[model samples]
Target: MIYKVLASILLLLVIIGGWSWTEYQSARNTLAVPGEQVSIDIKKGDSFDNITHKLIAQNVNIKPFWFKVVAMQEKATTKIKIGEYVLKGGMTAPELLAVLVSGKQKQYSITFPEGWAFKEILQEIAKNSYIEHTLTDSTIDFSALMAKLKVEKNHPEGLFFPDTYFFEKNTTDIAILKRAYDKMQVVLNEEWGKKEANLPLKSPYEALILASIVEKETGAKVERPLIAGVFTRRLEIGMLLQTDPTVIYGMGDNYQGNITLKDLRTPTTYNTYTIKGLPPTPIALPGRDAIVATLHPAAGDSLYFVARGDGSGTHVFSASLKDHNAAVNTHQRKAN
Candidate 1:
């Protein structure tokens, strides 16, 4: 009787092992495609069962039962990352499992251009599928996220380096912003280490502030240093920066092409015409070129510059207040 019982148990074990092996083989065949591409979107907070159902409903040619079994065996059912995946049409179960486990999903490139403010940046992020556009207002409440990240700042302006970032679709806007900020930290630290000694900047943060000003002063690719020099000189002499862009930024959405005397005299922290120093924070995102220009301004005592109004995106730098006024009159007042 004991022998009989032992034989029965051995037979059951063999049958169970064979069934498991067959199930795995079936899964591999179900997903095996050669060259076709299957685009799949995995949303955030999706469970294994839901993801299986989604795939089945999409006619992905993946067997739900076997896929679930394989996922469970590989401990990947709960681990499929949320993102857009470009699965090759004829890939096997193992291949799909490997891709999901390794988190090799489709990536979309999102670019943040230079001179964009936080609101613009957020808008750009919202326009991309990679981010959740929750804040529809002009001013985003960055305090909550900043506090969560333990960052001491209320806004991350110059802190986010402008670059083309690759992200999986359905990513949160905050996550993308954090990535930009992290990249900025790396770039800022590297550049700060190479800065010239005795710069008027008290810290890396100050350099970024000056860079932001330089970014707004000129759009000319090669004239960033001269613009930086203008601001740095004014800062050294305790002259009000007197930048019109700050005024424009202060006016926000209400700013038309016209700048009134009242606008310049507005009692705002960003009104460089009234403020003797840098604003409380950066006005826009400064590119690496602007950042470099801030650390190495052109050698000059000229304290003024004016737009040429030629629509060539260039400015004329002047040394004396009289020269600046003459250019302004000739280019701006007389022409307009």
Candidate 2:
């Protein structure tokens, strides 16, 4: 009787071992998505069961029990990250498990062009589906926000760098803003260190102000340093920067595209013509090229510039008001 019991126990053990081996083979060899790719969004706080259900919901034929066992065996249950993932055709259960364990998520991008206003930047953030929108009028107290971000300035304008930023899903607007802000800080500091001798700018902030002016002056990449030259020369000579862009910015929403004599004569902190110095803050976000151009401006005697008006975005540089007036008249005739 004891021999019979021992034989029965040995048979049961062999049966169980065979079943486990077959299950392992099935998991390693079977493709969850046979011929087509599948996309799944594993949200934050999703459990292993939830992820399995999501895969099944996408018509992937994964065996949930075996998948859970594989995940546990590989210690990938807690390693899975949240984001959109793609499973390609003929991806086996083990391959899918490897992907989830790797924690690679889908990336999205947002771009901020030079001279974008703070409002426009916020609008772009608001419209993006991948970013987490945490900013609202209710949460924004300018002073508090600045304090929270540890920015020394009182305003948020021109603080964030203009660049294309990529991030995973659920990234907050503040997080993106912080990245841009830190980039600006590093770039501005590096450029400030390389600034030409006898610069009129007293600080990096002043250089940023001039750079923003240069950014608004022209879109031609080659002309940035030339425009910076004009402003730097004017500042050094104590000449009023009669640039129309500053006046337009000063006019705010009241500026209806045309800068009348009234707008130019209006007194505002941003009006370079009236202020006789750099604006109290940056008027718009400037790119790294503009910042670099301002710090290392082109060497020239030109202090005035007018639109070339031949439908070319280039400007005609002038050493005196007489030449500038002539260019203006020529531009006016072309406009007529």
Candidate 3:
């Protein structure tokens, strides 16, 4: 009788051990390989229970009770991150926990095109649902905004670098603007120190002004240096810039796409045709190439240019008005 009791106890212990091992393996195995991924947002101040609930709602259908038990055991609740996370199908219970605790939030991207005005940049930011919009084009006071950004500039045009910026959701538009602004300052200062000698520009800001004009003027990449050369030569000779883009910018809301001879005669702070030297500020955001071109213009005798009128978006260079007029007539006739 004693032997039989001992044998029974040993057998029971073996069965329990085998069951526990099986349960442990099952817990570790992939519960369900998600056929489709689902996004989950772990908001700030969310409790561990709330996170578990959110995971379930995101189609992470696993053994919720067991997953929770495992999470608590691993002390993952305290380390959960707050951000957007993607829950995939093939992840096991431990894998899901690892992902949640890893704090790998989803990131989104926004791009500001080269030559985009500060107003247009604001418009883009306001329309982006992911970015937190605390400012608007209509309400952004240049002085106040600059003060807040610690920038002592009178205006903010051409200050922000145009590029694709990535950030997690809920990031403010101001933050993005600040980053772009800082990037432009760094790039401008670095390139300004390497500028070519005898440039008409007196300061980095003046280079930015001309660079903005060059950015708008550059139809072909190769023409950038040539355009810069022409502008620089014109400035050296005290001739009106006569650039159409600056006139358009000056026209602002009144511009109807086409500029007439009358518009050229109209005067504004940004009207290069009517104003002498560089504009009071950059007319638009300039790219790195445009800035570099303005600072280091190619040496040439050409002082005037006209559209090639071959749909190639290229310009014809001329040193004299007679040559420029002849080329203009040829191209204008072709264009007409």
Candidate 1 — which residues are off by over 4 angstroms? 1-31, 34-36, 42-83, 89-94, 127-130, 133-142
Which RMSD does model 3 reach against the true structure?
Answer: 2.2
Give Cα distance to truth, residue 230, candidate 1, Å.
Answer: 1.2
TM-scores for the candidates: 0.77, 0.90, 0.92
Runs with alpha carbons beyond 4 Å of true place in candidate 3: 1-17, 31-33
Q: What is the number of backbone collisions in each predicted candidate, taken in the order shown?
A: 6, 0, 2
Error of 2 at 253 (Å): 1.0
Please give, for residues 1-336, the per-residue lDDT of candidate 2 as tens digits.
999999999999999999988997787678778567777888889999999998888888778888888788788889888778777888988788777777776678999999998888988998998899878867787777778788888899898999999998888988999999999999999989988999999999989988998999898989999999999988999998888878888888998878877787789988877888888888899999999999999999999888887778999899988988898888866776
Alpha-carbon error at 304 in model 3, in Å?
A: 0.6
Name the TM-score of candidate 2. 0.90
Q: Model 2 off-target regions past 4 Å?
A: 1-23, 33-37, 88-90
**Candidate 3, 94-116: lDDT as tens digits:** 88778888988778999999989
Model 1 lDDT per residue over 1-336, tens place: 999999999999999999978877888765554357766678888887777776666566667777877778788877788777877777777677767677788988898889988778777877776567655566556787687556788877677889999887666776777789988888887889998767789988999888888888777879999988888888888998999878888788979898999998887878999888998888899988899999988888889988888887788889899999999988878658
lDDT for residue 171 in candidate 1, whole number 0-100: 69
Better of 1 and 3 by TM-score: 3
